[model samples]
Target: MTTLTRTLTDTQVVAKRNLLKIVRVPEILVAVLISPIMFVLLFAYVFGGAIDPGDGTSYREFLIPGIFAQTVVFGATFTGAGIAEDMQKGIIDRFRSLPMSQSAVLAGRTLSDVVYNVLSLLIMALTGLLVGWRVRGSLLDAAAAFGLLLVFAYAVSWIMALVGVLVPSVEVINNASFIVIMPLTFVSNAFVPLDSFPPALRVFVEWNPVSTLTQACRELFGNTNPAAPVSDAWSMQNPALYTLICVVVILVVFAPLAIARYRRTSR
Candidate 1:
């Protein structure tokens, strides 16, 4: 076999081995499974009545895409926590001593987490459907919307994994990651229209990645119209562009940092 082919084979083997560990410990899957459902239930019943979407759609429809964004963001915290646990247990140290590609360890963990994210989204989508959350867009648009969400989720996973490598304890990983993520989720348009916020708050909300992602998904699902004014010169124009930009920004900023931190920690 060619050297390139051999390298690819080795990475795949390492990735598969990590995935096998996930299969044996089903609780990891369970935690991923429960989070999205909890978000749907808590937000749909609790805060749905308080929010005015202005589009005349039921609150549930208006909120699903936002909840999808929020859930994926919340779900990413596990990436760091899991990695920290493995490191503390010496699993990562042992892997470092092996003749495997350095990238494979982080790649495997992040990719596996993406699979878990997909399953979580699927389950939440099914539950949302049962509760009357319908996508008004075409099937292609719905698929595109979901595809973007997964891409965003995967991008965020790298950042979270970097935190895992840098933090001294798994407990810190659990608390500190959410302290950053939860505020971003709440301060954005996820739970309310950005117009309702005061001017100072509105500026921050406009630039938030979670808001951009939610607006993109909402437009894709036809839950809200793109031509409608979110603010002056910001009408949710070009949702695909927004998703693309967020994904690119995240990958460009976090990918190298994650790799560098992993290499340093694994040493």
Candidate 2:
């Protein structure tokens, strides 16, 4: 078999193993499914009235895309936690004994986590509709919007995979991810209007990958404020392009790192 074929075959085997674990440990699936619904309700009814996207957009409309971006990015944590859990159980040693592609283990872990993210997105989309979030754009545009979110999410899963392999404990992965992810999501335009940020933070928010992803979603989902002024920053001006760049850069940098870490650990 060709090297590429071998890698894909190994990756499928590893992905099936991970997916079976989710079926066995159903609470993992339950948590993934529930949190986005809570976020939708909390932000829609609880905080929706207070924060305005301003200029006649329903806060619920604005909120759903941001929540979509945030939740999927957060979902990437499963990749790390899963990797850490497997390492602790000495599962990597078993994989090491097989004649498989070295990159397949990490690749499979990240790919399987995409299934988790997709299920969460579907549940959240249904909840968003119940809360008055509508997709005003063409169906193709909306599909592209979701496609971008998943691509960006898959990139983040690799980052977490690296961290998971580097860290000694599955519990530590959650704590470590929270420390970084909270700031990235909160400090951006996810839950609030961009104009609310101060000058220094606004710059950061404008350039933040999370913010760009949110912006990209808003445009594709047809949720942007018509009156909002267009920013000159390259990231804000072309958010879809910007977000795609972030996805590519993240995968290029982290996928190999995670694979190398897995190899070292197996040894």
Candidate 3:
């Protein structure tokens, strides 16, 4: 077999092993599935009334995409925490002794976490539907929106992979990721209209990729209000393209770095 084929085969094996952990340890699946559901309910009923998407759009519809973006972004933490746990438990040492490609270890971990994110998104989608969120776009567009989310989430997993390989423990990985992610998700137009923000912060929010991701999903899902004040920022105006670019940039910068870090740390 070619080197690339061999690597892929190894990666699949490792990914299967990692995925099986979810079945063996059901709590991991439960936690991954529950958090998104809770977020859907909390934001849909508790805070949905106070927020408006303008143009008479249902707040629940506006809210669900933002929740989806946030959930998937937060789900990237699983990659970091899982890696940190493996490193702490000396699983990396065991993997190193195997005949498989070394890169498979990181690839497999990130790949498996995509399934976790998928499950999270599925549950959140169901909960959102129950709470009055509906897709106004065509089925193809909704599929594209979901595809964009998964693509972005996959890129984020590489970043967490680097953090996981570098961090001393799972707790540190979780804490470190939270500090960065919380601000990114909140400061964006995710939960509220960008018009509500102060000018200075609005500029950041307009350009924030998280904001663009949410905007892209809203646009693709047909959830945006015609009367809503839109950002003239290039990123916001071209959210889908901009988000795709961000995904490419992130993977280019972080994927190799994560792999290199894993190799060095495992040794």
Highest-scoring model, lDDT: 2
Q: lDDT by residue for model 2 over 1-267, one digit each (tens)?
A: 999999999999999999998889999899899999999999999998898877489999999999999999899888999999889998888888888999999999998989998999999999999999999999999999999999999999999999999998998999999987899999998898888888889999999999999999999999887678756799999999999999999999999888887888852
The order by descending TM-score is: 2, 3, 1
* lDDT, residue 145, model 2: 95
Clashes of each: 0, 0, 0
Q: TM-score for model 2?
A: 0.98
lDDT of 2 at 134: 94
Candidate scoring better on TM-score of 1 and 2: 2
Pairs with steric clashes in candidate 3:
none
- Residues 3-69, candidate 3: write the lDDT tens digits: 8998899889989999999989999899899999999999988998888767578888888999999
**TM-scores of all models?**
0.92, 0.98, 0.97
In model 1, the Cα lDDT at residue 14 comes to 62
Candidate 3 all-Cα RMSD: 1.1
> Which ranges of candidate 2 are over 4 A from the true structure?
none
What value does the lDDT take at residue 149 in candidate 3? 94
Error of 2 at 206 (Å): 0.6
| 10 residues in a row with least lDDT, candidate 3 | 258-267
